[model samples]
Target: MRNAGLGSWPHRRARMAPKREAFSYDGVSTTYEEVAVRTTKLARRLEELGVRPGDRVSYLGANHPSFAETMFATHQLGAIFVPLNFRLSPAEINYQLADCGARVLIHAPSHQVEHERAISLDSYEDWLAGGSEEPLDVPVTIDEPALILYTSGTTGRPKGAVLSHANLLWNTFNLMIGVDVTTDDIALVAAPLFHVAALTQTLLPTFIKGGHSVITPRWDVDECLNLIEGYGVTWMFGVSTMYADLAASPRWPTADLSALRVLLCGGASVPDAVIHTYQERGLVFCQGYGLTETAPGATFLEAADSVRKAGSAGTPVFFTDVRLADTGEIEVQGPNVTPGYWNDPVATAAAFTEDGWFRTGDIGRLDDGHLYVVDRLKDMFISGGENVYPAEVENAITDHPDVAEVAVVGVPDERWGEVGRAFVRPRAGAAVDAAGLREFLLPRLAKYKIPVHVEVVTELPRTGSGKVLKPALRRLPLAPAVSPENAPGR
Candidate 1:
């Protein structure tokens, strides 16, 4: 039988050790039995709110124990859980809610006022007060949809990816065997639970292992360090930017990270220098690559291969097939793959190939079984008839000694059709100029591949998960285009 819900997982854990801690946040802790009771009550509350089986229930909140409880509760009733990005604007959240045809929205009190209309779970005591605590009859099949995660929509409007219970369960089990998670493990969940990266890599795996989860309210570097020490956090997941901030934080080096056994970084590529910095400190750093469509974990560079693979996103997880199309697009197929986009039949049809492989818009190449991401296919542009991948130029620029961060995008060019433009954040206490950057990258990149313009900024605009918002960058007013000789491009 497939293990997909609390009914089976909780019963198995209760027989093994019901008293063991299953989750912790702030000072509150919940065991398997406690989780079961709360979820049962919440399920009843959801039913009282008129949420029937297969109905979409939206959640707009930060990462907390309640979020996980609510997700499980929704699952118990065979309802689809749509966790909205807490950082998105109300309109963005509303778009997703309406797109999914959500029947009810359960939000935390902190975010209740922010949402135009939402039922606060913090005030749910009154609602559940009169409701029954008995578990709702769960008729969930392995193939039933469980989650509707909206993509970041970097290229266009976001699309909700529908993930089945089997997709999550199988992915969680795959992560367990691939990462070797144990019951004694305590996972530090710093990434937003709304993202599939956190949900699949940390939350689901922790529950499946009967392990403890330390939920952080937000991603504060010092607070994250403190939580690691406070809860004896054994494993954690963060993006490359988070790791960079943590490594450069004042609390690091002095902070006791001895309890940490693994640190997974992804959502974007990691700098080689950053990887070396962690290795020099005896930290195990692994990198992974996936999209919301793949239940967020298609490939993972194991700790053992971290140094060897360097910048690779590692091999595909068990049962997942990762292939590079002849056109250089990444294609994925497996049980973990999402069924399709919600209410987007045209997009759903366009997303898959003739044989059913999902065409990931990413451009990548395989070197001895390891995936090296070149860039996003959509992010690539032709400059002076030469193909320019923004990620490549951005990576090169970020590697500069005085550069702290960078983003590369193509701008409308009346002469060349399009030209590469770079926005950079220089390291503190260091001096960097556009001319100097041009000189720095001139030898490292092709003549046409070098950015035609460079702008220094305090920081690049990013999503909550640290992905560079190139669309926002594109909206900025045009700057003077520079040529290879440090003059106007022309």
Candidate 2:
């Protein structure tokens, strides 16, 4: 309660609840007392490496107890913590490090990253074991950049979002009300912890509330389901696709999921059907909407409203402001919003409005104070001068019984300038074809919004957070351009 600095939480909790389990990973569990002690030791070791305040300390690894320890250690010395996405290729990972000017790099045992400043997990512990287990008293304010998370960069080069201690603390306040966190809550962090959604939205809040967190190195449907039953995980966050896969699990029907209170989802809008799948099992799907720049916790749909107001991202949380620009782009202004991108003044200027509103780049509409996301502004295309949002078209296409998952992208057209192409992934045992899907969408969507081409595929390329990789999908070769005029029965 003294301050919401990342380094202070474990120390405070250790005094209040020393024996309480903080985070459980693989087969090992760390108590609040243990976490505070471990982070203190690591902080001293980092100082021995000449890490100073304002320097960047980057961590690249899977979900391990050491990730949290590294975060606390970096912030304790007022150094910036940079968590690299393990899913990124070595080149991409190296690009982020060079861009941030990281001085120290830490990786998991399994990875063999050959950087002059890099240290493996074993070496990290060896250093920690030898260092003094005393807290470092460095000058740190709430406004200091505590963490830097590089964006996925679906469009251009990746930019590092500079999240300050204040930003993260405010995000936890939003999450506490968003998910109703409590001391008894045990969150199963199945998603990649490097992402803001999983770390700030779930794990950080749980830690602050003196609750327990269970980590999975990677998401395996079976392992996640087992943890929910085995550990009695009360809350967890994942994307819509993860939920879809969970519902499709063979043990889903029989799994004892009564212990779960909230099943949080974001990254992309949850399909209406996917929401129903969890609802049928007595689970609440709290779909959220936000960006990494906003410390990633903004709006969250309530459990009760999940069904009645199916596709809405709900209202803004406490201390957050969500408004629309003249162009209908969602603009946010709040303490949770990052001060700016790391070392990029030009990009930072363009990210905000003249009056300081952070441009979210996402297009959405507010209905009765609730937010309904349309699609990304960049993803929207013009067909014969009419605007087409792929999400609107994709929703109609998903109504077909056979279509399981779908990604709609705008392809170049000679007649309309730009037209939509449907990439369909059929349900497990169902069959799908182009003409049939087009006919199914005709009545549900406007004729102009109807896709000119529909190609059935086994799967759509997706990000670690479950967003469809539209940039990658656009690079794929289509079978043949099937115009509306070429409709099978036309």
Candidate 3:
């Protein structure tokens, strides 16, 4: 009972609700008592593998019960857990494994990591069964590092954000207070748990409440819809794109969604159309705004205020404090915020202010007690002496029925210092010409704010967390300035 970190949660939950279902995957369910036993066995195995205090144990796989088990086991031995994005290439994964100096790596089948002991998830059962489940009560502290999550490296190399046990616990408290996850909740975890939002924002809080979680390895529109109806899911978390896909599904009109009580959305702004689509079905989204550094729960837009503050990210969470710099950059200070980046002293120093607040590089606005994230400060550009935020323009463009997705970036212009160029992916069977997009924007945005050029694309590149890779879009070759009538075809 000396463990004060996340590793202690499994046993704690088992003591309180031993028979309650903890998590389910692929039609199999595990109880809290079972999870605690497995966690102890895994911890002992890891300890035998030379994983000591402060050592790192990395996990590379999809959303499975083993992920949570490995994380708990790692922390139980007073070691740091590093969860790698399975979507990344082997080279990328190797960099993170080396960067963190991982002692052991638990990965899915066919995935390889150059570590001393690489344990495949296929053999995870055998691995767990071999270890003796004798009691392991390592003395750990709340401030000790629990996770090292890597940032989506859009600009340069990805840096690991070191989150302490206190940060994770505070974030869980904030989410519980803001969204109300109860013991009766049946949560659907469709997002990848490797991402901070899915892990801390969705799974951890539900686990703490002793709620049941239906975990999926990957997202499939029909599969998710079926799980919701079959399991009578009461709570779920997803990004804007996932929600949009669900709403666009053929069965959306007749799908059984009456059991769903809470839908938490984040990672990007939810288009007004997507919001209306769900509202017409008698469901309201509880949208939040945050980054991995803040344990990913800085603000929450309660379902009650969702309609009133349509585009706002909502107010700061219960324990987090948010402030906007004169330049509109969002700064956060709270127990939930990460202490700093792993092994990068220079980047850590640059990420925080002299006084201690973490500088979230993104720009935002405070209005009527709500926070509206305008755009990334680096993403904004001045066009003809007027500052332009792509998110504002993108939101306006998404209103067009033909558009499925769009990304705007500033390209060098001959007349203006810089001009907005939009890359749009049209909805199925929609032509979505540049002229029509311009005509649609004419009434919605200022002349300066509208994208000067539009190009129809088949798909937009996105990160594993469902965020648009703007840097990739900026790297694309600029198409010629075409007249609306002569716009290129998709």
Candidate 4:
């Protein structure tokens, strides 16, 4: 085998488990042998199109078997795979295409992306049919880059995080140790595959373990619930919102979810109400925390620790090193950590410490041998000379039965330097009010820590990655502060 990267996996798994099911999508199942054959043919076709080693190949679409096949095929030719968020506009999509200098753009018909060399997934089968089925044994090393995942760009422009084969492999190894993925596992990939949480955490690990992956193009609460029972899915990955929607679904109370073994949640902290909903159904969530640069798996809280250490991000993965700086910023160093950003030396240099640890730009604290992520370093606000983390407050507020989602930001205050303002979304039919929310928080939070102002909104602006767009929230018109001393009920 000339390839020492992920390109070798398909063929290796084919030999080990030729008849084992690898992926299931839209009622069609593919075996390891079949996947390997498709991968080889696709690699040959890509090579014929002049995709050389070190060339960038981009994929734009939702969750599909083609996503996995294209990733493996691109790696098979020793090229890098860049998965774009389909939700992005044509302009944003083109910006990423040009940023990566992608040689070929393989996209779905739904996306209106423009590129010089584009291959529509509509003609994907015909494209592969023309290429021979012979194996492509490209000489790829562990240090060679495999993926260029872009950050969410909440504040500034998104930077491409270059992850090597080693980084991804070590991340998978860490996940195997942390979650114990097995061959009998059937993972439901309901989340978008473009995100590292779904790709590196669920899809790749399941593939490495020879487990079957059931991919849904996009998330639909009812469809996911039905697929979990129909396919007997053992495990799956999702964000906080996805889990919340599942719990809110009408079928949730009677859905036959006995086949589900574990549900992995990340992208944000899971609220106490959401966790309790799943717990009441005899299922526990395994929460994780990381960035795209860390191959997305720095820490994972096992199901056993979900209750005792509810809000903690858990300890670092087996192969990662995690520590807090003097300023409470989380620093990570490990094989799974990315080397640097792609083609941006200035950003790359600034991303790491002088001694080489990647500065996570996230504030965290260590307690009881676990890491609790407080908030983004820049997101923390000082209220009345006291520091407050929005995540901590949001977590507490979402615990209210009527509250579905909440985002807190520091609004300018005349009394205090800056006070917290909560933008809350109530449950579907609930009539939750700012006064009721304030009363609910009276016992749960300190007087100074509670939001001085609250606004009930139908929705909060969010980024493509499901993170609340705090900047947008900050731009909204501010209301006069309601001081704790002179508030309506205080």
Tens-place lDDT digits, model 3, residues 1-490: 8999999999999999999999999999999999999999999999999999999999998899999999999999999999997766565578789999999999999786677789998889988999888989999999999999986343436689999999999999999988878988999998889889889988999999999999999889999999999999998998776787798899999999999987888777777888888887778787888888999898999878988898789999999999998889999999999999999898899889989998887899889999998767667664533346677678778889989988989876644446788999999998898777887776555466677788889998999999999899888888787663322110
- Give residue 14's error in model 3 in angstroms: 0.3
Flag regions of model 2 displaced more than 4 Å.
Answer: 1-4, 153-155, 380-490
Model 3 off-target regions past 4 Å?
153-155, 379-490
- On a 0 to 1 TM-score scale, where does candidate 3 land against the true structure? 0.80
* lDDT scores of the candidates, listed in order: 0.79, 0.82, 0.86, 0.85
TM-score per candidate: 0.77, 0.79, 0.80, 0.79
TM-score of 2: 0.79
Error of 4 at 97 (Å): 0.6
Give the top-scoring candidate (lDDT): 3
Which RMSD does model 2 reach against the true structure?
Answer: 11.7
Across 297-353, the per-residue lDDT of candidate 1 in tens digits comes to 888888789888888999998879899999999999999998998888888998999
Off by over 4 Å in 1: 1-12, 112-117, 380-490
**What clash pairs does model 2 have?**
none
> Looking at candidate 2, what is the lDDT of residue 348?
89
